[model samples]
Target: MGAATTRATRGRRGLPWLVVGLWVVLLAVAAPFAARLGDVQRDRATDYLPASADSTQVAELQDRLPGGETTELVLVYHRADGLTAADRATAAGQVAAVAHRHTLTGTPRGVPSADGTTLVYPVGSNEPGTDEKKRDAFVADVRRLAHGEGGLTVRAGGPAALATDASGVYASLGGPLLYTTVGVVAVLLVLIYRSPLLWLVPLTVAGLSDFLARAAAYGLNQAFGTTVSGQSAGIMTILVFGAGTDYALLLVARYREELRRHELPHDAMRAALRGCGPAVLASSGTVAAGLLCLLAADLNSSRGMGPLGTVGVLCALAAMLTLLPALLVLLGRRVFWPLVPAHGSTPVARRSLFAAMGSSAGRRPLTVLATGAALLGALALGTLSLPGTLKQLDTFVDRPDSVTAMETVAAAYPERSAQPIEVLTPAARADAALTAVRDTRGVADARRGRTGGGWTEITVTASAPPQSAAETATIEALRHRLPGSHVGGPSAQQLDLRDTDARDRTVVVPLVLLSVLLILAALLRSLVAPLVLVAAVVAVWGAALGLGGLVFGPLFGFHGTDPGLALLSFVFLVALGVDYGIFLMHRMREESLRGSEPAEAALTALRTTGGVIASAGLVLAATFAVLTNMGLVPLVELGFVIAAGVLLDTFLVRTYLVTSASVALGRRVWWPGRLSRAPSAAPRRVPEPVA
Candidate 1:
């Protein structure tokens, strides 16, 4: 009998070490590939475009042409008053020097603005071919030559130059993003745990999880030809640290409780995992399912985000559940130091903030519920104030040289667009397409530019400013008149982006709702609970967006909202916001199952789980808030909405509204579940509050 008991004990102790060993081996194998992930991230416009977009087709065809993609630029030399004789001579000498230094399609001609303040030189070269690095190098060389001297300002602006600037920003994101996320998570964990030693454990585990997620993402890309971008990759890292540390906090909180009840550290951890594992699994599963719904989106960036985000979340879950437990058990109770939970001890009694909140909520459940709903409804109205769809030149938080030059041309040439729209048609029908383009209503001029690969390229300049309604109408006219021809270029791509975003929202939003509902229904075993949670999150989303509308233009000075902002922010907030809902509801259900009265169960659940949920919400919000510091306007908007939504959901919606709703609904909140049918009975005992 003693030998049997000893064998069982050995088996129990052996498993955690075995799990740790396997993870170590996995990390060792993944290290090399993970380091290479950054090298493959592509941030070009084509990477994010819809697969069937005309711009995408044009880009692909251009890549297959003899010289590959042509590098296009507009060199703008500006003088506030007017160009002096020397300024004109300087411009002429530099244009000659540029032509002499590098290969050109033809002799560049200078077009003088009617105002006589700017000289615009349209330059094209195929020297960079299809290589992004070489293209950036070429643009850098040209920019060096196009410099301001005295009162004249020379700037390089065009599609190629803009791509170079964007790529530079993407390249710099890796180190700063990672370091900032880690630093943020570490500080939050330290503050939440309030223990010098305990915070380090979870932060370290989160870092390891981030590394593993990157490794897995790289593997997916290599095996499946997955599209990877800097934006998606950066968001994935944030999820790893944010979501992983969240899970860690829950587990650690539960483990601390279990330690006071069980005699042995190993036994206590087993109890902790048993207590919180399903909630953690369900939370992570819902987030994963919600993100995976992005695969239904037509946009490349949105689709790619689905897999990368899922990888980050799942990796974090794995590390926190397995590695965290192993480390806790090995380190024993001493890790908590000055505030350790000694064997056979009970937690000290204290009046927690959540307890006070629950007491107030329980007193007037319906009033609280109504007030919260009204507040959310009021906030949702802010959406009407949001600015129009963002312009390409306004996508960056700080205007780059390309945007400045584009602006200069727009101001100088208000009657005509600065950039040309590219039309690719069959070589046999070149004359027809060219004639059709010229005859288009809003076209200022149309000219045959390049012909190769059985295709002919025609460049059309709009009579209106770029991305204006008039320019868009002209593009539509060209597309309608010319069959088997694609209308492309920067303006066309922006139009395609807006259209795709609308299409993606119609498809992906419904899919996310359905996926989250199914997961919650299965986890909570109730139809009403899932619906309540979904409705709450949706309200939170509307309010968050409305708040953005209020501050985006007036407060932050963001001119236009990103096309993808609404959809991306909705997915993240719903998935992540519902995370806290699951934690609270899961506990509420557990209390009901233990035979606590409905009101008692709801309040107890809030009192017990509220602190941890608040901590997790803060961590998640702070991590996403890091995106606002990035250079791109879309990222900034996305970060702000999500961070704001999480805070709203956590403090107001989840705590006050959800708890009060549960209290008001009583057993009906768990409709069709056995607990709802069971007669009201006394709970076994009131749980002691943990510090």
Candidate 2:
């Protein structure tokens, strides 16, 4: 008997090392592919467009044109007071130099403003083809030549230049975003654990999970031609750390409790896995399932993000469940030193924060519930204050040279559009298309530009400034008049994006709700409990968006909201917020199963799980908050809203509203499940078993 026991102990001890070794090998194989993920990431507007949109068709046709898509730019030279001969001469000399150096499409001519304060040159080139890198390089070379001298300000602005600026921001996100996220997670972990060694285990495991996710994403991209955008990729990284760390916190908390009763680290870990495994699995599944619904979206960016984000969540789940547990067991009880839970020891009794909260909630459940609901409703009204859909110029938090140039042109050329609307037509109908374009109302001028691939390109300048209502009206007229021709440009793309986002919301929202509710029902085995969680998360999402409206314009000085903001925020908040609900509710169910009274079960569950859930929430919120530092307005908005939503759900909704509602409902909360049946006359406290 003694020999058999010794053999069993040895086998359990060796298991963790074997698992760790396997992970090391897996990572080694994945490292090379993961390193190249950033190379394939694309942030171009056309990359995100719906496949059937006119703008997308134009972009595709342009690739087969004579120039393989034109790289266009406007060189703006300005002086506040007025332009002198020297400034004009300097501008002319620079334009000539640029034309000589690059393969410019036509001889450049400067068009002076009526006020004589600004000079603009429209430059176009097809030499760089459709290669983004080459196009960016060409734009950069042109920018270098167009420089400010003394009073004259020289800037480059156009579709190509703006793309270069946005890409630069996206490219910078890879290194800085990763480093900042890691630093934030590390500091939070240190504070939460307070044990120097204990924090490293989960952090390391999460890092590995992130790397694995990247490799898998890259494979998906290469194998299935999945569109991987900068926005989607960044969000994936955030989830790996934020959601991954959350699962780790819950498991560690349970393991610590198990350690107090179990004699060995291996036994404690096994028991811990059994205790919290279902909840962890269910939570991760809910997140994964919710994200997958995005595949229904018409927007390529949103659709592609679905699978990639799911990969991140699943990888994190795998690592935390397997690798994290193995590491914790291998390190032994000493890993949690300075506050170790020794074998055979019972936890010290104290008045926990959750207990106090539960008491208040139990006393006046309806009142607490009403107040929370009211607050959320009031906050949701703030959505009305949110600005209109964000424009290209206002897309960045920090204005780049391209945005400044475009703004200057818009101010200077109020009567004429600085941006051209591109129309592609069949070569045989080129003359008819040109005639229709000229006859169209609101067109300042229409001219044939390029011919290739059996198609003719016509550039039409609207009488109104770029993106103005008049210009949009003119675009609609052209599309309506010329049925076979495609109308596109930066302005047209934005219009398509907004329309597609509206369509996506109608389709994806209900699917997400259905998916999450089903997962919760299966896990909790109750209809009311699932509905409560779903309803709470839905309220949280609305309130969060409403909060964005209140601050986005007034406090942050943002001019407009991203088109996809509401839908994306709803998906993230509801899916991620339900994570905490699962933790608390699973505990409450366990207590009820052990024969605790309804009110007692709710309070006890909160007391045991509250601290861990709060800590996890803080980590997740802090990690997402890092996105606020990004230069892109969409990223900043997304980060702020999600972070704020998580905090609100954690400290307010989950802690107060959920607890109170559960207490008020009691066993009825679990109606249709066995737990809903009448309880025994006396409560029974199940004794802890020895391992």
Quality of model 2 by C-alpha lDDT: 0.90
Q: What is the lDDT of residue 575 in candidate 1?
A: 98
Measured against the true structure, the TM-scores of the candidates, in listed sequence, are 0.98, 0.97
- Tens digit of lDDT per residue, candidate 2, span 227-278? 8998999999999999999999989988998999899898999999998899
| Candidate 1 residue-wise lDDT, 274-294, digit = tens | 999999999999999999999
Superposed by TM-score, candidate 1 places the C-alpha of residue 568 at a distance from the truth, in angstroms, of 0.8
